[model samples]
Target: MPQTERPVSMIDPSLLLRPEKVYDDKPIEAFRDYSIDDSDPIKERVRRTYYDMHTNQTVDFVKGKMEKWLKFNHFKSTVKDALIKLNELVDESDPDSDLPNIVHAFQTAERIRQEHPDKEWMHLIGLIHDLGKVMAFYDEPQWCVVGDTFPLGCKWGPSIVYGDDSFKDNPDSYNPKYNTENGIYKPKCGLEQLMMSWGHDEYLYRMLVHNKCKFPKDGLYMIRYHSFYPWHAGGDYKHLLIDSDEEIKQAVLEFNKYDLYTKSAEVPDIEALWPYYEGLIEKYMPGVLEW
Candidate 1:
């Protein structure tokens, strides 16, 4: 089925990002090398994390996680409360910012606020986008909750970060049935049917769905697929996208700029910023939500 949904009205959040984008964006004045590769310990850990993620995040693994996580019965908490809990998380998969996940949450949300002030849902999405990562602090390992996500059952696309050699160790890579392009999925099968690697993206997406969040689909799409580097950033997996995804793809791209490039030393004052976000949460997602 071609995912032919009506277009959503949302601002292009990426337009607000300046050309500097992120650190290690080659030619940056900063001497610190932030790009993911050898030598830098931070980037190295990120690489090793990706290697483990690519190795273990098989189709069955993702399905099992869905069975457990999609239940949304882990715990109950309001959106603001969940954000505070997320403060304890540090995404080992991210080579960019090492600050507490709470800081990054405010940073992303604040940037979106600057760009699209009227879109309170967008701001809220940025704030809680990685809230699912709190799963790391609970019981899940960093590998399962963080990193660039790609489809599990299909032939792993080449565009995934560290995909070529890193996935070589993955058991699925050895299986002839799963190694070919389009394995287990037909051409242009909409992403709705695909199983992305189990992580914050899917966790939070399903959480919102289970809670019956009132946010627009575009914001939901951004929350769900922000970590899908293979699809939105690398431009792979197009063969699998249906026509309706064109709208969603644009929203994801717009959301990506703020999510990826907004990391900085500037931290959002939790005290000062709490009120606005609280209202948005109350308006859109109030009360104790199922985890």
Candidate 2:
């Protein structure tokens, strides 16, 4: 797949995900080297949101949050309607990507289709992977809704984009057990034994698992942990994973090729692509996806 050129921005705050402290406390080199430019408005906005998410989320708070908000009532509308609302929110946040959320989904999915047509299941995964973002419409705060995801029970890595120093304020950071590299997990224990930060990825994974869809397990792992930079991109916390997680890890790595490489300005015609995706959804999912 070809790489998407990072868009330029006229505004002060770039809307891409990063931290305010990242700009203030650390050198620019400390941040991930993406193609995006400093002037990109979306980059700074994304940075502020990341700071909020990392600063506020505590282990126990996220756990209680999953318990309270994990029900299907959160997403009662059709997929199209949900996509429309999600796009509206994105529009308000970053006007540069004036494309609708559905457009983003179609772009990502169509790119996957063009690259690996044989992986039909992967095509569907790309389409709806971020559907759980509909949670934003339910009044969920942006901090809890999106940003980098990491295992809650394990040691938080300094490598995660936000200022790891700020995590000292998090209650879990004090728990002596969770502060270590291994934390609660044994070596190579696998990600299934881990609890990732509560967010859209896990919600969508559970939705697919509950429906028993024909999508590849690897694709599901991609949806579940794509935001898990600590393990995937940083190479931290691998010690906590078990042997079974190796399969899932390898699968996620495969999906990352498409995820990172597929974001391009060239978008597919939604009118033409909708039928294939709709059919795939009906074939795999039940009459109604609970949310």
lDDT of 1 by residue, 69-134 (tens): 888778888888888888777788776678989899889899999999989899999999999897
Clashes of each: 0, 20
TM-score of 1: 0.88
Taking all chains together, each candidate's TM-score versus the true structure is 0.88, 0.79
Q: lDDT by residue for model 2 over 1-291, one digit each (tens)? A: 012233321111112332333322333333333233348766666666665676667678777877776655554555555555666655222323446667777877887888889888888888877777777767777667666677876678655654465475677777887777777777777777787777778877877676566776687888998767667766667677666776877777666645544443467788887788877777665355566
* CA shift of 166, model 2, Å: 4.0
Each candidate's lDDT (Cα)?
0.77, 0.65
Which candidate wins on TM-score?
A: 1
What's every prediction's RMSD, in angstroms?
A: 7.9, 7.7
Worst 10 residues of 1 by lDDT: 1-10
Worst 10 residues of 2 by lDDT: 6-15
